[model samples]
Target: METSHPGTGDLATRATEILRELTGRSDAAFRDGQFEAIEALVKDRKRVLVVQRTGWGKSAVYFVAARLIREGFGGGAGPTLIISPLLALMRDQVAAAERAGVHAATINSANATEWDEVLGALRDGNLDVLLISPERLTNPRFSEQVLHPLLTGGVGMIVVDEAHCISDWGHDFRPDYRRIGALLASLSGDLPVLATTATANSRVVDDVAAQLGSDTTVIRGPLSRDSLRLGVAPTSSPGHRIGWLVQHLGDFSGSGIIYCLTVSAAEDTTRALKDAGWDVAAYTGRTDAEDRARLEQALKDNALKALVATSALGMGFDKPDLGFVVHLGAPSSAVAYYQQVGRAGRATDSADVLLLPGTEDAEIWEYFATASMPEEADARAVLAALADSPAPLSVPALEPLVGIKRTKLTLLLKTLQVDGAVDRAGTGFVATGAGWAYDAARYAAVAEAREREAAAMLEYEAGHVCRMRFLAEALDDPTAHDCGRCDVCAGQWWDSSVDAAAESGARKILSGIGVPVEPRGQWPGGMEKVGVALKGKIPAGERVEEGRVIARFTDLGAGQTLRGFLAESAEDAPVPKNIADWCITVLSEWDWVERPTVVVGMPSATRPVTTADLASGLARVGRMVDAGNLQLTRDPGSPEVNSAFRVKNLDGAFRATAETAAAVDGQVVLLVDTEIGSRWAMTVAGRALRLAGARAVLPFALALRG
Candidate 1:
């Protein structure tokens, strides 16, 4: 039987003091569920799971519990350990810990130079709280040398923030979290644990609860925000959404976030909003770490009107006064949407939350949904490769043999390790020979769950239900009720019109073409170890020139149009006229140091017309000679893999005829493709032409895909 604390009045009074100190409010007191969570951890010393909305004092519970446990106020001792996914934002948490008079330290990538110092502090008992990231759990040395000691006795309580990740993305890309979930379940009962999240639905909640332990205490509350006024604006196209933002941004009271589904959409929105004279910045995965920190501070300072961002800015970014949140495209699940919009209306009396639904959202959703989950064949191939290897093989070395991309291969290996099929050996992996079975039934169930969540999102958009109530119900919130503040109940509060001039300008910005394709400066690492006969930098004399493409495949204007023609289901037809025209337009604007005098088409088994038309048309318009084709010796493999695999996949895949070589000799040659994905295809083709005596190679394509 689980031990229950007999008295809570003393613990609650002491907890109130810590809470007031943490929040800097003399009158501050625990919310309805906060005191209970703290008392359970501090007095009862049992596992506690708190499912509450953001800004409901989840962090306060752990911070106060750490204090009480350290002070022996609840018959407990030792430091508190927090595993947060928001590694980059750990600094803010550390600062928050200080305000409560608790000494906190963290060992994360952002503070790599201070790891030794932080670890020392932990061992010396000078630190009251230690924050860690889930990704760090993958490091073998840290787990063995550092984490092992702390879990043995140094940690009094453990807090898992954004705990839904334990059962959600953990199953897909983050195997470390899944493994940690198992580790947490095996913890000694006397060592208290707290798991908290604002986004978990009933399904995710149950999954997390099962991992925590059977006797875990669950404290759940209302997911709806009374201060939020939810609404959805009808916008058919990307331009219309951008135009709507440019026209109506002044209606909001203060700085906020504008969420985009993709990096390109964020950048496109940033440019459109900036062009229309709004103070904004783009935040995406590509944003530098330092720049992300700066942008977060700027947003908090209200120095900028908004930060147009992807999911990179999603969780753990706290700004209580955030005025509004507008989505350019809907997320795949209502739970995800609810978590994102929860960022707003936290401390404000009223905050605007709107969704501008796009026609392409479902397509983007399908693309991501497929990419996030690994196929069984890929997993089996990974295991087979590990079993075949005489020694441990790194992800890059394993990429070519297994034909799986490096990122996905790394994720798969971690999962295999967690599941007992493989073991981490230094930077590489070795087969454990434990004989793992593929959980096909579990994967199928997860797929079905995702589909149901996606369908619920569709219902949330147009089912005529109250928006807040729909989201709350989708999250399975027991306290959910119809909020009369939503657009469905109170009538639409935002205007749906876009300025015609602004719409045309946004279209122009979206349609603008000619994205520069930077040449690869060096060969990828671990190529020789994988048996690919290539190494070092491409000789300057044989390198391809800086290339150009009509647009990025993720761009809004020509990019979306390009997707329709290049989609998997679209046939191998002649190049679309609009695409050909865009190509000509991009070429006309090219200010090449030395213009090409000949064009060479790359052989394409799937897109012969597209390849030939682009090549012949460029030669025809530029008055350059057509140098025929670069023959395909074999399939070059998928261009979506990592650099090493991609580079090895294209080795000896292309060849040039002596006659075509003669035509290209001593002439600047224009290399053309329907799409310039990976750029390795062009790199290999260009090197072959250069080795055959072409003066220089310049690549041109309809779209650039990274």
Candidate 2:
């Protein structure tokens, strides 16, 4: 039988009976000390806070204690309320409670207008527990509609889920958390409080307690994920790091996420992965709502094997069975890293977090600093602009006058709001009495904080110590021990010991007062691929007609080399080595440059080559273009060609399949048959078109009116 320690003897017996009836296995995980803590809280009717990581079953701490309170000291039953940060979690908790034979109702944004039904359940004692979101709690109707009824009738316990949100000092500070304490103060004074979170440090614990406005009792367990093996790789280029990621992805099972620094990077990486034969999807703010929905569904169905996305992918929605979470760039803060990594390994499985650090990440940080830190003059100008406007100036309008980027201005506005200098009005800003006085000290402090975070990235990338230890320390868990599972403890299993030590040394170098030393050989490939392609090589071959040499372009002197045959011109004319030189000379002098691309058969030419053979025969087209091997120029001699080709699906008609629809974008094409008449035609840019119904134009534009 399950051993249960309730506040009173009668309640203890009832809880024991209840546990026996529910799970049939009743070993009391909570013993003498735990029982005493709850009994004292019940006796004094004091608030309690529980701090535990995921998989520790933190929910049990409150529910068990609340059940005991209800049985031992209650006129009938008092409702235990839970304020969850996520609406999905609220629903999940309610379902779990219902399965355990406890009645729980959830009131959140989804059904905010109909929350009275949820309150009706709470007031009539039909529910043992009621769950709501912080947003819902702040609703004007909540106090008038629910709190008054519950407080006057009776209340057993109050729980704050994802309690770390209350920590304004932490990286993931939610502004509404500041109001939670004030809201709690207005609730029934005698109601006991409980807070729970999967991830928490000492600072977060204090924040949670302070936000509750109660004498919070913290119950912590060991912070250990024995299964996860953490690793960090140092790279200088985002592209090279992505190549490394491609090499490692084949080893893991389940889905994965590759985080990019920008929306363009995310899309480019997704495309590269797809071209490399991996099924990939991308999610960014720029993605249309419809595409995001489709991609999200595709991820859940495993139709898309991986997702390359920005930070927007984290919110509580996606719960894929992720095998790994790879950071293509350094996260803005340790809190962001923890939250992103926490998405994996949620269930009884294990997942690894791979960090690829490069100069790009550092450069990105520098860019963020440069972009976000406005000049003192600009800040003053922003204040002046706001002062002049009667109504709050929209964010876009203030950008040109203030000389700061919109995002940075938003950050500044938020900071000013935090400091009581401004208030947000709709999509604009309104100045409070607090003005933007020049404070060098404040500027220094802000800059130093950002620099410290950048230095932490350097430390994480370069440290030879256990990565999990580095992560724990970065997250403010100073007492964290070596997990015996991370790369360092495993003897640099996923990374090079030499590289790791080099990074650590680099960090030390930066720590010194003088100009930081740029350690030679720190970056691979020495420099970015620029001016010339180091691997560029063009093969030489002799042209022949009917097994005899037709023309010899060999020994064409310095700077003039035979790259490839452009055409077999009806048994005449010398092939031009430089198309641009030929075009410039001909088009400028004769007003025409015509170069044909053709192949001669074996009998007709010394060597016969098919188009198929020549397609990849060109050694790196991009490199050739870069090296001026293949040149382009405007041919003024011939008017710019204007023509359109219509792709048909075997019926000699404009109708196309989905595959054909996706392929024909940006190409000049004709639309006919079931669509608009041929007279209303256009040469559209194919890439911008979207598919609707069975067909879409090659280049999308406003429909032609016939």
Best by lDDT: 1
lDDT of each: 0.82, 0.51
C-alpha TM-score for every candidate: 0.74, 0.57
Model 1: per-residue Cα lDDT over 348-410, one tens digit each:
999999999898999988877765566889988888888899998877578778876544676
Tens-place lDDT digits, model 2, residues 1-706: 1223444466445545444433346664444334544554556666666654454555555565566666644332476877776544554566556544567787754443345566676666677888876655433466677876776777778777777767644544554454567767877666777767656667667767776665666666555455566777756565566555555565656777788876645755664565457888778654433345556667667677678988767644445466678888877666557667766666635787777766667666776665544466666777778888899877656766676645577666554555456666654777776855656775576577667766776776776677767667665564667878776777555633233433343333222111101111111111122212211111111110111011112112211122123212222223333532332232122211221121111111212232122212221221211101111122111111111111111011122344434333322221211111121111111111122121222211111111
> Best candidate, TM-score-wise?
1
Cα deviation of 577, candidate 2, in Å: 31
Relative to the unseen true structure, what is the C-alpha lDDT of residue 248 in candidate 1, on a scale of 0 to 100? 92
lDDT of 1: 0.82
Considering summed lDDT, which 10 consecutive residues are worst modelled in model 2? 541-550
